[model samples]
Target: MNSLKTVWAIAWRRFSENSAIAAEMNGRFIATVFYCTVLVPFGILSALFMDPLRIKGKPPRWLQREPVPTDMDSARRQG
Candidate 1:
């Protein structure tokens, strides 16, 4: 009875260890596949079509400065 219990305990330990390692490996593989297939392609398509950065032709809005108000413009505004 004691020997049987020992064997069962060892088997349970081995199974738990193997399951933990397998779960880690499968999780990593699934994440990589999702990133490559879904996230990466969506990012590429959005960059190409949506122009989020305004990189196609027009400069980004932050890079453009509003035209400085000239003295004439100030005078006109005052008038």
Candidate 2:
């Protein structure tokens, strides 16, 4: 039918436009796939082998919290 031909023409036009953009970024697309497929696993394996808890240094300051004061006065006030 004529309607089917019109639908195919529109679909092909959109596909061609999208393919042009994809071709322009082909290198970046490959790099992203490579990083996810390779570097991400390697990094995860390295972390597992390194014993993350055994790192010999002070933890980042943001992770350190001020000790909660356990004074009897504060506890009685809340209760």
Candidate 3:
């Protein structure tokens, strides 16, 4: 009985010491999974649908056959 108690006490002590490390590892794994499965896929889908960079807004000047006139002529003149 004393040897069993000693083993149990040692096991409890070791578990107490390592609990923080074990919790931190679990937290990091969960965060990584959330980032990969949720955040990454959401970001990709949003980028696909939303055009965050506004790449579709205007053609590059070099790509345009004719120079496009600006709608804000007064602003251009002021600049």
Candidate 4:
């Protein structure tokens, strides 16, 4: 579309005007693309396969944490 092209052209002009900032922005854009295309899908597949609720293996230590007391009395006692 013409609007899209115009937007891209403006962006390119700005990018060309600031080489150092453009390089940093380009790195961030690549990182975002990589995360969206690769890391996020991989994480989803890992979570699906390693269903935390199913517990096929020894669960992580964090999951075994004892509940902390939340009442005011318990907090006062601790303090």
Top TM-score: which candidate number?
A: 1
User: At residue 23, what lDDT does model 4 achieve?
Assistant: 89
Compared with the true structure, what per-residue lDDT tens digits does model 2 show for residues 11-31? 999999999998879978899
What clash pairs does model 2 have? none
User: How many clashes (backbone N, Cα, C below 3 Å) per candidate?
Assistant: 0, 0, 0, 0
List the candidates' TM-scores in order. Answer: 0.64, 0.35, 0.49, 0.43
Looking at model 1, residue 21 earns an lDDT score of 100
Kindly indicate the candidate among 2 and 4 with the higher TM-score: 4
TM-score between model 3 and native? 0.49
**1-79 in candidate 3: lDDT tens per residue?**
9999999999999998899889999999999999999999999899778976777878676643775566798568866
lDDT per residue as tens, model 1, 1-79:
9999999999999999999999999999999999999999999898768965556886557776688677887878876
User: Candidates ranked by TM-score, best first?
Assistant: 1, 3, 4, 2
Which stretch of 10 consecutive residues in model 1 shows the poorest summed lDDT? 51-60
Off by over 4 Å in 1: 51-79
lDDT for each of the candidates?
A: 0.89, 0.88, 0.88, 0.89
For each of the candidates, the C-alpha root-mean-square deviation to the true structure, in angstroms, is 6.6, 10.7, 9.0, 15.0
